[model samples]
Target: MFSADALIQTSGNIVGGTAGAFLGGYFAIKVMRTQIEFQRKQNQQEKEEQYEKTYWLMKLVFEGLGSSIDDFQKTMNKPDIDDKKDYPYLIGLLKGTLSVSKEKKELINDNYIPKDIYREYLAGITLFNSCEFIIERWYQTLHLDNFKISTDNYQFKDLIVYGNGMRHIFNEIESIKPIKKKVTTTGGGAK
Candidate 1:
């Protein structure tokens, strides 16, 4: 039979080892959760910034286009060009600035620009460097050729007024980003 003193010591050691393991496991989980939370917050912030940047740039482009379209409509309605008439300033502005605002230009230029035209496509390239701002040439049948023409004024106006639904979409996106992220992260929700 085992001695009573030996049994007491063994029971004490078992309890101590279990308590140590439990504390270690709890601390490790706490540290892991803290790191995960930090990562989640950082990612959420980046997503918000990206959404805002895209929203603002698109809004500016739409505004510029809408302004130009308005001027075009007014000019087209006029019977003849008057020597005294001061041309719409935006006509030159779009031509000069590619319809991009100063802030948008700074954002676009932050990405590295490569001189070589023929370079392999790389993932994670900024939207500015990757996307092309192109206006397909639309020939105005009667007198104008090689000019970009927008057919609908109302749609263009809407685009300027509302950056093509980005505002609403981003609002919903932001709501999801901030609230109940843990539930969403758990992968239980339907897409």
Candidate 2:
């Protein structure tokens, strides 16, 4: 049998314990939610940063390669140009500019890229690679003693045709706001 005073004291303790447990659980959940939200924001920030880095890299590559292509065409047309000197210089410039794109290519598949412009971005990359491929073939002939200026201007012609599209895509990408990708969905469902 319990004394009346003891019963009241036990009741009070049980109530206190229940309230303490509830409060502790509630605060614990609040802290967890806060941490999760913070993590999400941090992830978003990282994605935006990656997007910016990729954008700048692409910009430099497009401009650099485009300029090199133009110079190659002009140099090729020069009647008095030295094949050994000018051709190698233009090839070196193109390859050097392309190395930047090659090194950071992993960023192309990142989630930060804008969905609408992804195809164009890929097209630009393809054009770049095509140009590099042609240049590599030409570079292979450089060591030959019989090296002569070949009149196969078709590849450079194709590059000229695509250069306009690349410039347009660059402008469109530049106009995009940072982290605009978050508002869009990566999966297929509804708009």
Candidate 3:
């Protein structure tokens, strides 16, 4: 019952509607992909910033605590000195420098840390914590437990041992490029 012109117009309307829907869907998908990529880039930048920040913090800590006694030794020109006789005194003298501020604690946060590199940060911080622990224990042994100056390098050696390993691991982590973690599966799903 429709005229030829009316039928053509109806067909054109249907085609136009379908094409518009398809194009709309396509653009929506493209926008979503762009947003996702943008988010990923933003996240990557944040992670890099966090990595640099934490790295510098640990580096300062290492310089302050790791080499404090050694620096003193080297400065005092007593590399040949017996660690047993000197460790406690060194700890006592350096006790004032071994402190944690609120700002330092804020650097070791969970929010900005990437999931793959948590262990690396943890290892570095553990080294730092070990130094603090050793200093406190030595202080306590002298003041609280023994109530006398005990010259021993046991605590110092323990902290230094962990610190050496921590430095190695931290250096390795620093060398790693900030790319997606790749895993090679050798048939057992081990990454």
Return the top candidate by TM-score: 2
Q: Pick the candidate with the highest lDDT.
A: 2
26-115 per-residue lDDT for model 2 (tens digits): 999999999999999999788778777777777766666666667666777778878777767766776676676566554455466667
- TM-score for predicted model 1 compared with the true structure: 0.48
**Model 1, 66: alpha-carbon shift in Å?**
2.1
Model 2 alpha-carbon drift over 4 Å, by segment: 73-92, 99-117, 141-152, 177-191
C-alpha lDDT (0 to 100) for residue 47 of candidate 3: 76
The CA lDDT of each predicted structure is: 0.43, 0.70, 0.63
Q: List the residue pairs that clash in candidate 1.
A: none
What lDDT score is found at residue 93 in candidate 2? 73
Q: What are the C-alpha RMSDs, in order, of all predicted structures?
A: 11.9, 9.3, 9.8
Q: Rank the candidates by TM-score, best first.
A: 2, 3, 1
Clashes of 3: 0
In candidate 1, how many Å is residue 124 off?
A: 22
**What is residue 77's positional error in candidate 1, in angstroms?**
2.0
Q: Please give, for residues 47-133, the per-residue lDDT of candidate 1 as tens digits.
A: 556545554554454344445444545664466644233232323433444425434544633233222211211211222221213
